[model samples]
Target: SHFIVGLTGGIGSGKTTVANLFAEQGIDLIDADIVAREVVEPGSEGLAAIVEHFGEHVLQSDGQLDRSALRECIFSQPKQRLWLNECLHPLIRKRMLELIKQSTSAYAVLVVPLLFENGLDSLVDRTLVVDISPELQIKRTQDRDGVDKGQIENIIRSQMPRQQRLDKTDDIIDNQGEIQEIEQTVFALHKQYLSLSKAVLS
Candidate 1:
Protein backbone atom coordinates (compact mmCIF):
# COMPACT_ATOMS: atom_id res chain seq x y z
CA SER A 1 0.00 0.00 0.00
CA HIS A 2 1.11 3.58 -0.63
CA PHE A 3 2.07 5.74 2.32
CA ILE A 4 -0.74 8.01 3.51
CA VAL A 5 0.21 10.94 5.71
CA GLY A 6 -2.47 12.94 7.51
CA LEU A 7 -1.51 16.63 7.64
CA THR A 8 -3.28 18.68 10.27
CA GLY A 9 -3.11 22.00 12.08
CA GLY A 10 -5.37 24.41 13.88
CA ILE A 11 -7.14 27.24 12.06
CA GLY A 12 -4.58 29.54 10.36
CA SER A 13 -1.62 27.24 10.98
CA GLY A 14 0.16 26.82 7.62
CA LYS A 15 -1.12 23.36 6.73
CA THR A 16 -1.94 24.47 3.20
CA THR A 17 1.61 25.75 2.68
CA VAL A 18 3.00 22.41 3.83
CA ALA A 19 0.61 20.58 1.48
CA ASN A 20 1.91 22.73 -1.38
CA LEU A 21 5.45 21.61 -0.58
CA PHE A 22 4.27 18.03 -0.82
CA ALA A 23 2.71 18.92 -4.18
CA GLU A 24 6.06 20.32 -5.32
CA GLN A 25 7.57 16.96 -4.49
CA GLY A 26 4.97 15.22 -6.72
CA ILE A 27 3.09 13.53 -3.87
CA ASP A 28 -0.64 13.08 -4.39
CA LEU A 29 -2.65 15.39 -2.14
CA ILE A 30 -6.19 14.54 -1.03
CA ASP A 31 -7.59 17.76 0.33
CA ALA A 32 -10.75 17.21 2.36
CA ASP A 33 -12.03 20.73 1.70
CA ILE A 34 -11.82 20.15 -2.03
CA VAL A 35 -13.63 16.85 -1.68
CA ALA A 36 -16.31 18.42 0.51
CA ARG A 37 -17.10 20.95 -2.22
CA GLU A 38 -17.12 18.32 -4.93
CA VAL A 39 -19.62 16.11 -3.18
CA VAL A 40 -22.02 19.02 -2.90
CA GLU A 41 -21.94 20.09 -6.52
CA PRO A 42 -25.28 21.16 -8.00
CA GLY A 43 -27.60 18.22 -8.78
CA SER A 44 -25.30 15.76 -6.98
CA GLU A 45 -26.65 13.19 -4.55
CA GLY A 46 -25.11 15.07 -1.64
CA LEU A 47 -26.75 18.32 -2.72
CA ALA A 48 -30.05 16.58 -3.23
CA ALA A 49 -29.85 15.07 0.24
CA ILE A 50 -28.95 18.42 1.77
CA VAL A 51 -31.87 20.13 0.06
CA GLU A 52 -34.22 17.39 1.22
CA HIS A 53 -33.21 18.01 4.81
CA PHE A 54 -32.56 21.78 4.89
CA GLY A 55 -34.91 22.88 2.10
CA GLU A 56 -34.29 25.16 -0.90
CA HIS A 57 -33.24 28.12 1.22
CA VAL A 58 -29.72 26.69 1.38
CA LEU A 59 -29.39 26.91 -2.38
CA GLN A 60 -28.67 29.89 -4.58
CA SER A 61 -30.93 31.18 -7.36
CA ASP A 62 -28.65 29.33 -9.73
CA GLY A 63 -29.30 26.12 -7.73
CA GLN A 64 -25.81 25.92 -6.23
CA LEU A 65 -25.21 25.80 -2.51
CA ASP A 66 -25.22 29.31 -1.14
CA ARG A 67 -22.22 28.78 1.03
CA SER A 68 -22.14 32.23 2.61
CA ALA A 69 -25.79 32.06 3.63
CA LEU A 70 -25.33 28.50 4.83
CA ARG A 71 -22.25 29.47 6.82
CA GLU A 72 -24.11 32.23 8.59
CA CYS A 73 -26.96 29.89 9.48
CA ILE A 74 -24.70 27.15 10.75
CA PHE A 75 -22.35 29.39 12.73
CA SER A 76 -25.29 30.81 14.62
CA GLN A 77 -27.19 27.57 15.13
CA PRO A 78 -25.56 24.49 16.56
CA LYS A 79 -28.43 22.12 15.73
CA GLN A 80 -28.46 23.28 12.13
CA ARG A 81 -24.69 22.92 11.95
CA LEU A 82 -24.68 19.42 13.35
CA TRP A 83 -27.54 18.37 11.08
CA LEU A 84 -25.67 19.71 8.07
CA ASN A 85 -22.48 17.94 9.11
CA GLU A 86 -24.37 14.71 9.52
CA CYS A 87 -25.77 15.05 6.01
CA LEU A 88 -22.48 15.87 4.28
CA HIS A 89 -19.67 14.19 6.21
CA PRO A 90 -20.42 10.61 5.27
CA LEU A 91 -20.74 11.54 1.61
CA ILE A 92 -17.51 13.49 1.73
CA ARG A 93 -15.71 10.69 3.55
CA LYS A 94 -16.87 8.10 1.05
CA ARG A 95 -15.65 10.16 -1.89
CA MET A 96 -12.35 10.93 -0.22
CA LEU A 97 -11.75 7.25 0.46
CA GLU A 98 -12.44 6.40 -3.18
CA LEU A 99 -9.99 9.04 -4.35
CA ILE A 100 -7.34 7.88 -1.94
CA LYS A 101 -7.74 4.35 -3.14
CA GLN A 102 -7.18 5.52 -6.72
CA SER A 103 -4.01 7.49 -5.99
CA THR A 104 -0.92 6.32 -7.90
CA SER A 105 1.83 8.13 -6.02
CA ALA A 106 4.36 6.41 -3.78
CA TYR A 107 2.37 8.05 -0.96
CA ALA A 108 -0.60 10.32 -0.57
CA VAL A 109 -1.11 13.33 1.72
CA LEU A 110 -4.47 13.92 3.38
CA VAL A 111 -4.80 17.57 4.37
CA VAL A 112 -7.50 17.54 7.03
CA PRO A 113 -7.86 20.43 9.45
CA LEU A 114 -9.84 18.35 11.94
CA LEU A 115 -7.81 15.15 11.62
CA PHE A 116 -7.73 14.50 15.34
CA GLU A 117 -11.00 16.18 16.27
CA ASN A 118 -12.86 13.99 13.78
CA GLY A 119 -10.83 10.86 14.56
CA LEU A 120 -9.58 10.75 10.94
CA ASP A 121 -6.06 9.77 11.99
CA SER A 122 -7.11 6.15 11.61
CA LEU A 123 -7.22 6.64 7.83
CA VAL A 124 -3.51 7.40 7.51
CA ASP A 125 -0.17 5.70 8.12
CA ARG A 126 1.34 8.78 9.82
CA THR A 127 0.24 12.17 11.13
CA LEU A 128 2.04 15.45 10.49
CA VAL A 129 1.23 18.36 12.77
CA VAL A 130 1.90 21.87 11.52
CA ASP A 131 2.52 23.67 14.81
CA ILE A 132 2.32 27.35 15.75
CA SER A 133 1.89 29.28 18.95
CA PRO A 134 -1.64 30.07 20.11
CA GLU A 135 -0.93 33.81 19.90
CA LEU A 136 0.33 33.46 16.35
CA GLN A 137 -2.70 31.36 15.47
CA ILE A 138 -5.07 33.95 16.88
CA LYS A 139 -3.36 36.78 15.02
CA ARG A 140 -3.30 34.89 11.76
CA THR A 141 -6.93 33.83 12.08
CA GLN A 142 -8.12 37.38 12.68
CA ASP A 143 -6.03 38.79 9.82
CA ARG A 144 -6.77 36.12 7.28
CA ASP A 145 -10.36 35.22 8.12
CA GLY A 146 -11.48 38.82 8.76
CA VAL A 147 -12.95 37.57 12.02
CA ASP A 148 -13.26 39.43 15.33
CA LYS A 149 -11.49 38.60 18.55
CA GLY A 150 -14.53 36.86 20.07
CA GLN A 151 -15.30 34.86 16.92
CA ILE A 152 -11.67 33.78 16.54
CA GLU A 153 -11.51 32.73 20.15
CA ASN A 154 -14.73 30.75 19.79
CA ILE A 155 -13.47 28.91 16.74
CA ILE A 156 -10.21 28.05 18.48
CA ARG A 157 -12.09 26.77 21.49
CA SER A 158 -14.11 24.41 19.29
CA GLN A 159 -11.05 22.65 17.91
CA MET A 160 -8.73 20.15 19.55
CA PRO A 161 -6.19 21.97 21.68
CA ARG A 162 -2.63 22.51 20.42
CA GLN A 163 -1.17 20.36 23.18
CA GLN A 164 -3.41 17.41 22.32
CA ARG A 165 -2.58 17.72 18.63
CA LEU A 166 1.15 17.79 19.37
CA ASP A 167 0.83 14.77 21.64
CA LYS A 168 -0.74 12.65 18.85
CA THR A 169 1.45 13.67 15.92
CA ASP A 170 4.06 11.32 14.48
CA ASP A 171 5.94 14.24 12.89
CA ILE A 172 5.81 17.98 13.48
CA ILE A 173 6.43 21.00 11.26
CA ASP A 174 7.09 24.11 13.30
CA ASN A 175 5.46 26.93 11.32
CA GLN A 176 6.19 29.96 13.50
CA GLY A 177 8.97 31.20 11.23
CA GLU A 178 9.49 32.74 7.79
CA ILE A 179 7.96 31.13 4.70
CA GLN A 180 11.36 29.88 3.63
CA GLU A 181 11.88 28.15 6.95
CA ILE A 182 8.53 26.40 6.63
CA GLU A 183 9.43 25.33 3.11
CA GLN A 184 12.76 23.96 4.30
CA THR A 185 11.09 21.90 6.99
CA VAL A 186 8.53 20.55 4.53
CA PHE A 187 11.23 19.61 2.01
CA ALA A 188 13.16 17.71 4.66
CA LEU A 189 10.03 15.89 5.78
CA HIS A 190 9.12 15.08 2.17
CA LYS A 191 12.49 13.42 1.69
CA GLN A 192 12.13 11.51 4.92
CA TYR A 193 8.67 10.19 3.95
CA LEU A 194 9.92 9.13 0.52
CA SER A 195 12.88 7.27 2.02
CA LEU A 196 10.63 5.52 4.49
CA SER A 197 8.17 4.55 1.75
CA LYS A 198 10.95 3.08 -0.40
CA ALA A 199 12.34 1.10 2.51
CA VAL A 200 8.93 -0.30 3.36
CA LEU A 201 8.32 -1.34 -0.23
CA SER A 202 11.76 -3.00 -0.46
Candidate 2:
Protein backbone atom coordinates (compact mmCIF):
# COMPACT_ATOMS: atom_id res chain seq x y z
CA SER A 1 0.00 0.00 0.00
CA HIS A 2 1.13 3.57 -0.59
CA PHE A 3 2.07 5.62 2.42
CA ILE A 4 -1.03 7.48 3.58
CA VAL A 5 -1.08 10.43 5.90
CA GLY A 6 -4.40 10.95 7.63
CA LEU A 7 -4.79 14.73 7.93
CA THR A 8 -7.44 16.10 10.25
CA GLY A 9 -8.40 19.10 12.32
CA GLY A 10 -11.23 20.56 14.31
CA ILE A 11 -13.98 22.60 12.66
CA GLY A 12 -11.98 25.84 12.47
CA SER A 13 -8.50 24.44 11.99
CA GLY A 14 -6.90 25.06 8.64
CA LYS A 15 -7.16 21.51 7.30
CA THR A 16 -8.21 22.56 3.81
CA THR A 17 -5.58 25.25 3.53
CA VAL A 18 -2.84 22.83 4.54
CA ALA A 19 -4.24 20.13 2.28
CA ASN A 20 -4.21 22.59 -0.63
CA LEU A 21 -0.53 23.19 -0.05
CA PHE A 22 0.12 19.46 -0.29
CA ALA A 23 -1.92 19.38 -3.48
CA GLU A 24 0.18 22.24 -4.87
CA GLN A 25 3.25 20.10 -4.26
CA GLY A 26 1.80 17.52 -6.70
CA ILE A 27 0.74 15.24 -3.87
CA ASP A 28 -2.36 13.12 -4.27
CA LEU A 29 -5.13 14.39 -1.99
CA ILE A 30 -8.35 12.57 -1.09
CA ASP A 31 -10.71 14.69 0.96
CA ALA A 32 -13.50 13.09 2.94
CA ASP A 33 -15.85 15.95 2.15
CA ILE A 34 -15.32 15.50 -1.60
CA VAL A 35 -15.60 11.75 -1.27
CA ALA A 36 -18.78 12.15 0.76
CA ARG A 37 -20.35 14.19 -2.04
CA GLU A 38 -19.04 11.84 -4.72
CA VAL A 39 -20.46 8.80 -3.00
CA VAL A 40 -23.91 10.36 -2.88
CA GLU A 41 -23.93 11.65 -6.44
CA PRO A 42 -27.22 11.26 -8.31
CA GLY A 43 -27.00 7.66 -9.48
CA SER A 44 -24.70 6.08 -6.96
CA GLU A 45 -25.73 3.33 -4.57
CA GLY A 46 -25.04 5.64 -1.67
CA LEU A 47 -27.55 8.13 -2.97
CA ALA A 48 -30.05 5.41 -3.75
CA ALA A 49 -29.83 4.10 -0.23
CA ILE A 50 -30.20 7.59 1.19
CA VAL A 51 -33.28 8.21 -0.92
CA GLU A 52 -34.76 4.89 0.16
CA HIS A 53 -34.14 5.64 3.81
CA PHE A 54 -34.74 9.36 3.99
CA GLY A 55 -37.19 9.62 1.10
CA GLU A 56 -37.19 11.73 -2.07
CA HIS A 57 -37.22 14.97 -0.11
CA VAL A 58 -33.53 14.66 0.49
CA LEU A 59 -32.89 15.03 -3.20
CA GLN A 60 -33.17 18.24 -5.13
CA SER A 61 -35.30 18.59 -8.29
CA ASP A 62 -32.09 18.29 -10.28
CA GLY A 63 -31.43 14.94 -8.48
CA GLN A 64 -28.48 16.07 -6.46
CA LEU A 65 -28.54 15.49 -2.72
CA ASP A 66 -30.01 18.54 -1.01
CA ARG A 67 -27.06 18.81 1.30
CA SER A 68 -28.53 21.54 3.43
CA ALA A 69 -31.82 19.71 3.79
CA LEU A 70 -30.06 16.48 4.69
CA ARG A 71 -27.79 18.28 7.09
CA GLU A 72 -30.75 19.87 8.80
CA CYS A 73 -32.51 16.53 8.95
CA ILE A 74 -29.63 14.64 10.51
CA PHE A 75 -28.68 17.41 12.85
CA SER A 76 -32.08 17.28 14.52
CA GLN A 77 -32.66 13.55 14.43
CA PRO A 78 -30.05 11.44 16.20
CA LYS A 79 -31.48 8.13 15.03
CA GLN A 80 -31.52 9.33 11.44
CA ARG A 81 -27.99 10.61 11.85
CA LEU A 82 -26.83 7.23 13.19
CA TRP A 83 -28.58 5.49 10.33
CA LEU A 84 -26.93 7.77 7.84
CA ASN A 85 -23.48 7.31 9.34
CA GLU A 86 -23.89 3.54 9.30
CA CYS A 87 -24.92 3.69 5.68
CA LEU A 88 -22.33 6.19 4.45
CA HIS A 89 -19.20 5.56 6.46
CA PRO A 90 -18.35 2.23 4.85
CA LEU A 91 -19.13 3.52 1.40
CA ILE A 92 -16.97 6.58 1.93
CA ARG A 93 -14.11 4.51 3.32
CA LYS A 94 -14.20 2.09 0.41
CA ARG A 95 -14.08 4.89 -2.13
CA MET A 96 -11.37 6.77 -0.27
CA LEU A 97 -9.14 3.69 -0.10
CA GLU A 98 -9.72 2.94 -3.78
CA LEU A 99 -8.55 6.42 -4.66
CA ILE A 100 -5.55 6.14 -2.39
CA LYS A 101 -4.58 2.78 -3.89
CA GLN A 102 -4.66 4.29 -7.37
CA SER A 103 -2.67 7.37 -6.44
CA THR A 104 0.49 8.09 -8.48
CA SER A 105 2.07 10.49 -6.02
CA ALA A 106 4.93 9.42 -3.76
CA TYR A 107 2.33 9.23 -1.02
CA ALA A 108 -1.23 10.37 -0.52
CA VAL A 109 -2.74 12.75 2.01
CA LEU A 110 -6.22 11.87 3.21
CA VAL A 111 -8.11 14.76 4.82
CA VAL A 112 -11.05 14.12 7.09
CA PRO A 113 -12.53 16.42 9.71
CA LEU A 114 -13.39 13.64 12.13
CA LEU A 115 -10.55 11.31 11.30
CA PHE A 116 -9.64 10.35 14.83
CA GLU A 117 -13.15 10.61 16.14
CA ASN A 118 -14.32 8.11 13.52
CA GLY A 119 -11.27 5.87 13.92
CA LEU A 120 -10.06 6.55 10.36
CA ASP A 121 -6.52 7.01 11.58
CA SER A 122 -5.98 3.25 11.59
CA LEU A 123 -6.24 3.23 7.82
CA VAL A 124 -3.30 5.55 7.27
CA ASP A 125 0.42 5.00 7.80
CA ARG A 126 0.98 8.33 9.47
CA THR A 127 -1.47 10.77 11.02
CA LEU A 128 -1.07 14.52 10.68
CA VAL A 129 -3.26 16.75 12.80
CA VAL A 130 -3.65 20.47 12.18
CA ASP A 131 -3.68 21.89 15.65
CA ILE A 132 -5.05 25.08 17.22
CA SER A 133 -6.33 26.07 20.62
CA PRO A 134 -10.03 25.68 21.36
CA GLU A 135 -10.24 29.43 21.79
CA LEU A 136 -8.67 29.97 18.40
CA GLN A 137 -10.93 27.32 16.89
CA ILE A 138 -13.95 29.07 18.32
CA LYS A 139 -12.76 32.46 17.10
CA ARG A 140 -11.78 31.30 13.64
CA THR A 141 -14.95 29.34 13.12
CA GLN A 142 -16.99 32.27 14.36
CA ASP A 143 -15.24 34.61 11.95
CA ARG A 144 -15.36 32.28 8.98
CA ASP A 145 -18.80 30.71 9.34
CA GLY A 146 -20.59 33.18 11.59
CA VAL A 147 -21.60 30.31 13.84
CA ASP A 148 -22.42 31.27 17.41
CA LYS A 149 -20.08 30.40 20.25
CA GLY A 150 -22.40 27.85 21.83
CA GLN A 151 -22.93 25.93 18.59
CA ILE A 152 -19.23 25.99 17.83
CA GLU A 153 -18.48 24.84 21.35
CA ASN A 154 -20.88 21.94 20.91
CA ILE A 155 -19.14 20.96 17.71
CA ILE A 156 -15.75 21.08 19.35
CA ARG A 157 -17.10 19.14 22.28
CA SER A 158 -18.30 16.35 19.98
CA GLN A 159 -14.94 15.73 18.36
CA MET A 160 -11.96 14.07 19.99
CA PRO A 161 -10.41 16.61 22.32
CA ARG A 162 -7.43 18.63 21.14
CA GLN A 163 -4.90 17.07 23.47
CA GLN A 164 -6.05 13.54 22.71
CA ARG A 165 -5.93 14.11 18.97
CA LEU A 166 -2.45 15.51 19.27
CA ASP A 167 -1.37 12.50 21.31
CA LYS A 168 -2.60 10.04 18.67
CA THR A 169 -1.11 11.89 15.74
CA ASP A 170 2.32 11.00 14.40
CA ASP A 171 2.81 14.59 13.28
CA ILE A 172 1.14 17.92 14.00
CA ILE A 173 0.97 21.11 11.97
CA ASP A 174 0.36 24.11 14.16
CA ASN A 175 -2.28 26.15 12.38
CA GLN A 176 -2.97 28.56 15.23
CA GLY A 177 -1.50 31.47 13.30
CA GLU A 178 -2.49 33.00 9.96
CA ILE A 179 -3.29 30.76 7.00
CA GLN A 180 -0.33 32.09 5.01
CA GLU A 181 2.06 30.52 7.53
CA ILE A 182 1.30 26.90 6.66
CA GLU A 183 3.03 26.58 3.30
CA GLN A 184 6.57 26.14 4.54
CA THR A 185 5.49 23.60 7.16
CA VAL A 186 3.54 21.71 4.53
CA PHE A 187 6.61 21.68 2.25
CA ALA A 188 8.71 20.35 5.08
CA LEU A 189 6.26 17.51 5.74
CA HIS A 190 6.12 16.81 2.01
CA LYS A 191 9.86 16.32 1.86
CA GLN A 192 9.78 14.05 4.89
CA TYR A 193 6.95 11.88 3.56
CA LEU A 194 8.66 11.58 0.17
CA SER A 195 11.81 10.19 1.73
CA LEU A 196 9.89 8.01 4.16
CA SER A 197 7.84 6.55 1.31
CA LYS A 198 10.95 5.88 -0.76
CA ALA A 199 12.59 4.07 2.12
CA VAL A 200 9.55 1.84 2.38
CA LEU A 201 9.65 1.06 -1.34
CA SER A 202 13.36 0.29 -1.23
Candidate 3:
Protein backbone atom coordinates (compact mmCIF):
# COMPACT_ATOMS: atom_id res chain seq x y z
CA SER A 1 0.00 0.00 0.00
CA HIS A 2 1.09 3.59 -0.65
CA PHE A 3 1.99 5.86 2.21
CA ILE A 4 -1.12 7.85 3.03
CA VAL A 5 -1.17 11.45 4.18
CA GLY A 6 -4.38 12.64 5.79
CA LEU A 7 -4.90 16.26 4.77
CA THR A 8 -7.28 18.35 6.82
CA GLY A 9 -8.15 21.91 7.80
CA GLY A 10 -11.07 23.92 9.07
CA ILE A 11 -13.68 25.34 6.73
CA GLY A 12 -12.24 28.03 4.39
CA SER A 13 -8.69 27.00 5.23
CA GLY A 14 -7.70 26.32 1.56
CA LYS A 15 -7.18 22.60 2.06
CA THR A 16 -8.59 21.87 -1.39
CA THR A 17 -6.01 24.14 -3.01
CA VAL A 18 -3.24 22.27 -1.23
CA ALA A 19 -4.72 18.93 -2.26
CA ASN A 20 -4.87 20.06 -5.87
CA LEU A 21 -1.20 20.95 -5.71
CA PHE A 22 -0.44 17.43 -4.53
CA ALA A 23 -2.56 16.09 -7.35
CA GLU A 24 -0.47 18.18 -9.75
CA GLN A 25 2.50 16.19 -8.50
CA GLY A 26 0.72 13.01 -9.64
CA ILE A 27 -0.34 11.92 -6.18
CA ASP A 28 -3.59 10.01 -5.99
CA LEU A 29 -6.18 11.66 -3.81
CA ILE A 30 -9.16 10.27 -1.90
CA ASP A 31 -11.31 13.26 -0.98
CA ALA A 32 -13.86 12.48 1.68
CA ASP A 33 -16.14 15.30 0.58
CA ILE A 34 -16.28 13.88 -2.93
CA VAL A 35 -17.02 10.45 -1.54
CA ALA A 36 -19.66 11.93 0.70
CA ARG A 37 -21.39 13.42 -2.32
CA GLU A 38 -20.98 10.21 -4.29
CA VAL A 39 -22.60 8.14 -1.57
CA VAL A 40 -25.63 10.40 -1.60
CA GLU A 41 -25.97 10.70 -5.34
CA PRO A 42 -29.40 9.92 -6.79
CA GLY A 43 -30.31 6.22 -6.78
CA SER A 44 -27.42 5.17 -4.59
CA GLU A 45 -28.20 2.93 -1.65
CA GLY A 46 -27.03 5.68 0.65
CA LEU A 47 -29.49 8.13 -0.81
CA ALA A 48 -32.25 5.56 -0.62
CA ALA A 49 -31.44 5.01 3.05
CA ILE A 50 -31.46 8.80 3.61
CA VAL A 51 -34.87 9.11 1.95
CA GLU A 52 -36.15 6.32 4.13
CA HIS A 53 -34.94 8.02 7.26
CA PHE A 54 -35.38 11.71 6.46
CA GLY A 55 -38.29 11.31 4.03
CA GLU A 56 -38.92 12.76 0.57
CA HIS A 57 -38.45 16.32 1.80
CA VAL A 58 -34.72 15.62 1.57
CA LEU A 59 -35.13 15.11 -2.16
CA GLN A 60 -35.66 17.67 -4.83
CA SER A 61 -38.49 17.58 -7.41
CA ASP A 62 -36.07 16.07 -9.93
CA GLY A 63 -35.49 13.14 -7.52
CA GLN A 64 -31.97 14.10 -6.48
CA LEU A 65 -30.98 14.58 -2.90
CA ASP A 66 -31.84 18.10 -1.83
CA ARG A 67 -28.48 19.00 -0.36
CA SER A 68 -29.46 22.44 0.89
CA ALA A 69 -32.62 21.22 2.58
CA LEU A 70 -30.75 18.30 4.10
CA ARG A 71 -28.06 20.63 5.38
CA GLU A 72 -30.63 22.87 6.96
CA CYS A 73 -32.39 19.90 8.51
CA ILE A 74 -29.24 18.53 10.08
CA PHE A 75 -27.97 21.91 11.24
CA SER A 76 -31.22 22.66 13.04
CA GLN A 77 -31.61 19.24 14.64
CA PRO A 78 -28.73 17.68 16.57
CA LYS A 79 -30.31 14.23 16.71
CA GLN A 80 -30.93 14.27 13.00
CA ARG A 81 -27.33 15.26 12.36
CA LEU A 82 -26.11 12.43 14.58
CA TRP A 83 -28.38 9.95 12.87
CA LEU A 84 -27.27 11.08 9.45
CA ASN A 85 -23.59 10.88 10.37
CA GLU A 86 -24.02 7.44 11.84
CA CYS A 87 -25.77 6.29 8.68
CA LEU A 88 -23.32 7.74 6.15
CA HIS A 89 -19.94 7.80 7.86
CA PRO A 90 -19.43 4.05 7.57
CA LEU A 91 -20.35 4.02 3.89
CA ILE A 92 -17.99 6.92 3.19
CA ARG A 93 -15.20 5.33 5.16
CA LYS A 94 -15.62 2.02 3.39
CA ARG A 95 -15.36 3.60 -0.04
CA MET A 96 -12.46 5.84 0.98
CA LEU A 97 -10.46 2.90 2.30
CA GLU A 98 -11.17 0.92 -0.85
CA LEU A 99 -9.88 3.82 -2.96
CA ILE A 100 -6.80 4.17 -0.78
CA LYS A 101 -6.04 0.48 -1.12
CA GLN A 102 -6.25 0.71 -4.91
CA SER A 103 -4.07 3.82 -5.31
CA THR A 104 -0.94 3.46 -7.45
CA SER A 105 1.16 6.42 -6.36
CA ALA A 106 4.26 6.96 -4.26
CA TYR A 107 1.97 8.42 -1.66
CA ALA A 108 -1.72 9.24 -1.49
CA VAL A 109 -3.49 12.27 -0.12
CA LEU A 110 -6.69 11.63 1.77
CA VAL A 111 -8.40 14.95 2.25
CA VAL A 112 -10.96 14.91 5.00
CA PRO A 113 -12.25 18.14 6.47
CA LEU A 114 -13.56 16.27 9.49
CA LEU A 115 -10.63 13.90 9.93
CA PHE A 116 -10.26 14.48 13.64
CA GLU A 117 -13.94 14.99 14.31
CA ASN A 118 -14.79 11.65 12.70
CA GLY A 119 -11.85 9.77 14.22
CA LEU A 120 -10.38 8.95 10.79
CA ASP A 121 -6.77 9.58 11.72
CA SER A 122 -6.15 5.85 11.83
CA LEU A 123 -6.72 5.66 8.06
CA VAL A 124 -3.53 7.54 7.19
CA ASP A 125 0.16 7.24 7.95
CA ARG A 126 0.50 10.96 8.74
CA THR A 127 -1.56 14.10 9.04
CA LEU A 128 -0.96 17.47 7.34
CA VAL A 129 -2.95 20.51 8.39
CA VAL A 130 -3.37 23.72 6.44
CA ASP A 131 -3.39 26.66 8.84
CA ILE A 132 -4.80 30.17 8.55
CA SER A 133 -6.25 32.81 10.83
CA PRO A 134 -9.91 32.80 11.76
CA GLU A 135 -10.25 36.28 10.29
CA LEU A 136 -8.95 35.08 6.94
CA GLN A 137 -11.22 32.05 7.15
CA ILE A 138 -14.25 34.23 7.67
CA LYS A 139 -13.22 36.65 4.95
CA ARG A 140 -12.34 34.06 2.33
CA THR A 141 -15.37 31.90 3.02
CA GLN A 142 -17.66 34.90 2.89
CA ASP A 143 -16.15 36.05 -0.39
CA ARG A 144 -16.28 32.61 -2.00
CA ASP A 145 -19.40 31.04 -0.51
CA GLY A 146 -21.49 34.15 0.27
CA VAL A 147 -22.80 32.35 3.33
CA ASP A 148 -23.74 34.28 6.42
CA LYS A 149 -21.02 34.75 9.05
CA GLY A 150 -23.09 32.83 11.59
CA GLN A 151 -23.30 29.76 9.37
CA ILE A 152 -19.59 29.81 8.72
CA GLU A 153 -18.95 30.21 12.43
CA ASN A 154 -21.19 27.27 13.12
CA ILE A 155 -19.19 25.13 10.69
CA ILE A 156 -15.91 26.18 12.24
CA ARG A 157 -17.32 25.38 15.66
CA SER A 158 -18.22 21.87 14.53
CA GLN A 159 -14.72 20.95 13.38
CA MET A 160 -11.72 20.24 15.56
CA PRO A 161 -10.34 23.44 17.00
CA ARG A 162 -7.36 24.99 15.14
CA GLN A 163 -4.92 24.56 18.01
CA GLN A 164 -5.93 20.98 18.63
CA ARG A 165 -5.65 20.13 14.94
CA LEU A 166 -2.19 21.65 14.84
CA ASP A 167 -1.11 19.71 17.91
CA LYS A 168 -2.16 16.42 16.29
CA THR A 169 -0.64 16.98 12.85
CA ASP A 170 2.71 15.61 11.70
CA ASP A 171 3.16 18.54 9.29
CA ILE A 172 1.63 21.97 8.80
CA ILE A 173 1.27 24.37 5.88
CA ASP A 174 0.61 27.98 6.80
CA ASN A 175 -1.62 29.14 3.94
CA GLN A 176 -1.86 32.83 4.72
CA GLY A 177 0.05 34.06 1.70
CA GLU A 178 0.30 33.99 -2.08
CA ILE A 179 -0.78 31.03 -4.19
CA GLN A 180 2.76 30.72 -5.54
CA GLU A 181 4.07 30.45 -2.00
CA ILE A 182 1.51 27.79 -1.16
CA GLU A 183 2.52 25.87 -4.27
CA GLN A 184 6.16 26.13 -3.29
CA THR A 185 5.32 24.71 0.15
CA VAL A 186 3.36 21.88 -1.45
CA PHE A 187 6.21 21.11 -3.83
CA ALA A 188 8.59 20.81 -0.90
CA LEU A 189 6.20 18.51 0.89
CA HIS A 190 5.78 16.52 -2.28
CA LYS A 191 9.51 15.85 -2.34
CA GLN A 192 9.50 14.96 1.35
CA TYR A 193 6.58 12.58 0.90
CA LEU A 194 8.24 10.94 -2.07
CA SER A 195 11.37 10.38 -0.03
CA LEU A 196 9.41 9.02 2.92
CA SER A 197 7.41 6.69 0.75
CA LYS A 198 10.55 5.39 -0.94
CA ALA A 199 12.21 4.77 2.42
CA VAL A 200 9.21 2.85 3.67
CA LEU A 201 9.08 0.70 0.56
CA SER A 202 12.83 0.01 0.63
Which candidate model has the greater lDDT, 1 or 2? 2
Off by over 4 Å in 2: 68-77
Give each model a TM-score. Answer: 0.89, 0.91, 0.91
Best prediction by lDDT: 3
Clashing residue pairs, backbone N/CA/C < 3 A, model 2: none
Candidate number that wins on TM-score, 1 or 3: 3
Error of 3 at 69 (Å): 3.9
Clashing pairs in 3: none
lDDT at 137, model 1? 89
lDDT of 1 by residue, 1-202 (tens): 3778999999899999889989988999999989989999997999898788778898999999998877877887989989988888888788878989899888899999999887788888899999998889889888888878888778788899999999999999999988898887888888888888888788
Candidate 2 lDDT over residue span 24-109, tens digit each: 98998999999988999989999999999888999999999999989988997989999999999999999998999899999999
Sort the predicted structures by TM-score, highest score first: 3, 2, 1
How high is the lDDT of residue 114 in model 2?
A: 93
lDDT of 1 at 87: 86
